[model samples]
Target: MLSNPRTVEKTALDEFISQYKAYIPKPALVKSEPVGGTLSEQIKRSVTVLDFVGQFVELSPAGRGLCPFHDDHRQSFSVNAEKNYWHCFAGCGGGSIIDFWMKWQDVDFGQAVKELARTLLKDRR
Candidate 1:
């Protein structure tokens, strides 16, 4: 039942940019635009899985916590610090920091990357 994500995602991304374009620093926006491999890698390297996802979910020791993507009664979400990725053994997919953000935020790939870039850019200054 996965709908065509491109259209919805594009609209969402466009809305986000239009709403926050004035607020985003020019330099940060440049890095995330087009959402390609180079920029994606840069953003991924700049962020830690625990640190980025921690803002949204409360993680316990060893990065074990309940899955935020599902109503789980057990600890199924695991964040691998060494690999900088996360997985929900309960069946939810896993990926880099941007992937986690995209699923949780229900936004497109570019939108997720852009938000991460924005945060990283703010920290640089």
Candidate 2:
């Protein structure tokens, strides 16, 4: 939550963006290795779905957690470390880190991939 009431907007996206930027510095975005299949492939290979999502949501040993996208009662959200993908059984959809990022940030595929490169490349790989 924003402490200053004069702030423009206080949406979840704003908070998420703030936390994400703090976690990954701006300078680190260009420090990634350029030796992957493609942009999206490189981003996905940089970090696993389990590790990435685990940063924001606490996951059990089975890679299960309360879905952050919805009012999840059960631990409908699960990550496949081996496969490097996540799925929310509550109909929220499922895919790799880039997919989840796109949904979380409410951005398009291109923008999601760009942001993922910034976050995953610096220290994860």
Candidate 3:
């Protein structure tokens, strides 16, 4: 009854695939907000860069200090208490407290935020 066995098999397989393809379900969409927006702000306002960074590295009266991220003889790190920010003139880039924590702890952004949140929210209760 079949002239070409290969063509008949191919046609049957195509029909079978078409019949089952529509039964497959598509993945669901998920919407989520990024971590550490308001909490980071709260910590930035409440904690100064000098006070926070001072715990790790000793700072001069002018807020200039050694950068732990790099090896150097001179202290090229500067912390601006008013702006609650820091920067390393030698090379190491600086930012908010979260940024410092991420580099120091060698963790990702989410882990850093969670770690910071634990300390920041400790006294809330």
Candidate 4:
């Protein structure tokens, strides 16, 4: 038996992109759905920012708190219930619920969808 374990090197961006593209279904093979309307409408209809955030971290009533995306001393994030949005005032920036998951988990777009889908499904019941 070999004493050392073999490890594969990281793929280059071009190679990675090519591999990702290969897995994407052709336009004819994919079904499309409309994501209609404003971001506010989408959030309001689907889920609240507080509820979404609670899936990843504990939050307070004012909607301001330490962001899960980065290390910080105080809570600087705020969520607008009526607007269905959030912003990190401590220089961390902010965006929609999907953006929060992407930043907090350091994941790519596809992973973010999967994570949110799973979370939302569980919440529904």
| Candidate that scores best on TM-score | 2
Minimum summed lDDT over a 10-residue window in model 1 is located at: 28-37
All candidates' lDDT scores? 0.83, 0.85, 0.82, 0.68
- Cα lDDT for residue 121, candidate 1: 56
* lDDT string, candidate 4, 5-122, tens digits: 2443345545766878978878777555446543333433578877777666666776766776678568777777677678888777677788887888888867876776665645
Q: Assess the local accuracy of residue 78 in candidate 3 as a C-alpha lDDT between 0 and 100.
A: 88
Q: Which stretches of candidate 4 lie over 4 Å from their true place?
A: 1-44, 122-125
Question: Please, what are the lDDT tens digits per residue for candidate 2 over residues 46-79?
Answer: 7678888999888999999999999998999999
Q: Estimate each model's TM-score.
A: 0.65, 0.68, 0.67, 0.55
- lDDT tens readout by residue for model 3, 19-112: 9899988788875544654666766665777888989888899999889999957999989987889999998989988889999999988898
* Model 1 lDDT per residue over 1-125, tens place: 11665557766877877998898776645444444456678788786988888888789979988899999889899999888899999999998888998999899999987887887756653
The residue ranges of model 2 lying beyond 4 angstroms of the native Cα positions read: 1-35, 122-125
Ranking by TM-score: 2, 3, 1, 4
State how far residue 84 of model 2 sits from its true place (Å): 1.1
**Pairs with backbone N, CA or C atoms under 3 Å apart (clashes), candidate 2:** none
Q: Between 1 and 4, whose TM-score is larger? A: 1
The numbered model that scores best in lDDT is: 2
Candidate 2 at residue 53, lDDT? 95
